[model samples]
Target: MGTFEGLVAFSVTPTRPDESIDEDRLCAHIDTLIAAGVDGIAIFGSTGSIGSFSEAERRRVAEVTTKHVGRRVPVAIGTGAMTTAEAVRLSEHAEKVGADALLVVPITYWPLNEAELCAHYRAIASATQLPIFAYNSPVLTGVDMTPNIIVRLWQDGRVKYLKESARDLLRIPQVKEATEGRLRIFGGRDDSIVEALRLGADGWTSGAANIVPRACRRLFNFANDSQNEFAAHILQRRLAPLMSFLMDKGHVSVCHTALEILGRPIGTPRRPILPLAGEDRIHLEGILRSLEEEL
Candidate 1:
């Protein structure tokens, strides 16, 4: 169940105008990723606006995605919440609803201590049999999961994988060496995928994949082979401009705009996070236009 590898595209939770999940559009959107040959599908990750939705909506998204996809590819659900109890409930729910794996982040309103962090994950480990990814996204979550913490979690057998998004490439090999290569790793940063692959990442949990899944997979395949590294790097350069944008701007807003550009509009970002507008929208349009041949 923990066998996540090679371009695990994060699905955008497309909502209707009323902000309920647009089930049909979400299905069609995921159909796009599957057709593009993405090795796995992840829902309700940061790209899915995990923090914005309620527990019920998150469950519905997980249930609907797993039910609709139905053994086509692995589906990983993000079970991160502000508290341990909420996270545990979501983890149990993900496993119950047939999620192939679980992605967990130490979400905290106040920054969590190392001990608090360990306890949070340990409780979740006790609650579910699903393989767990201890997600490390310092930018979004405001907490850095050091290699020491990940190593300790690995030692305790609490987390099965690390979805690393903290942009420091050295942490990949650091975690690998500390865990003796046991804790599987998925790279989450858009800009550093090539280096992450070279650093022995198992795969990438990508926001850009919501826009160009095929390119992400192609980059994964090509970069893995020394013979194809040159071609892969060349493609990565073409993709770099937009990749930079997705990171600089938020994933949800940029992806929503890019999808609309591709003539497949997924609704707006939930409020408190605004839609792409003015120069940002125009800039994104230019970026998409430049990549027509690649797309």
Candidate 2:
């Protein structure tokens, strides 16, 4: 169990027009991430549309990603499900298929108390020898894993990293202080990567990396190199608008649309959550155009 650090792409699931997973395109997407020089890949994550995939689909995606990535970069699979049993099953499958680490988001729907959340992660951590990064994304999961809970989990030496998506910048310091810097914190929100880095996050798990992996990589490098002005300029000009749409509309829709606009074969989001239409499309096109100019 070790840390898989640096700019990890929280991958977007590429699908066919009918919403089936597009395996070929997905592999190409992984290739793009690796080629763009990201340190690792986090597949089947929230940005990867894990919520919309069945357990079988999730495992298949992880397998394909691991196979494609091989030893080039570590591949972390999201093994978070609403039930402990399901999460355990997914975690075990990821271990079997050779995942380097697991990003465990809190179970959605039936909100668990802090004790329950700790137990849930402990169970999964015990189930596999693979490293686990507790993913805290309250906006989607509706459950916040407080720093105290994280500290308790870290004490067992099972939870190794944190993908902090809570968007509460204060929680970064709280987690750092609570854990005494034992747990490596990765910024999960794209727009706040620089802010998170300034506040002492170890790295980022970024959705924007889906389209502009090189740019995301550069931002991480710039921050680490202490080139704050250059990083900020890149974020404001190249990354901000797409991230804005992702925050305002929906992550999967915006990410998928951006990929399609960039000529990547990632199809639309699964239905009832359709692609951007009307004014949203115009706005996205403008954003993509602006982003293209920077590229």
Q: Once model 1 is optimally superposed onto the true structure by TM-score, how far is the C-alpha of residue 143 displaced, in angstroms?
A: 0.8
Instruction: Please provide, for model 2 over 205-260, each residue's C-alpha lDDT reduced to its tens digit, 9 standing for 90 to 100.
Output: 88888877878888888877764767566665567777777888878888888777
Query: What C-alpha lDDT does candidate 1 achieve relative to the native structure?
Result: 0.89
TM-score of each: 0.98, 0.95
Q: Least lDDT summed over 10 consecutive residues: which range in candidate 2?
A: 227-236
Q: What CA RMSD would candidate 1 show?
A: 1.0
- Model 2 steric clash pairs: none
Best by lDDT: 1
Report lDDT per candidate: 0.89, 0.84
The numbered model that scores best in TM-score is: 1
Candidate 1 off by > 4 Å = none
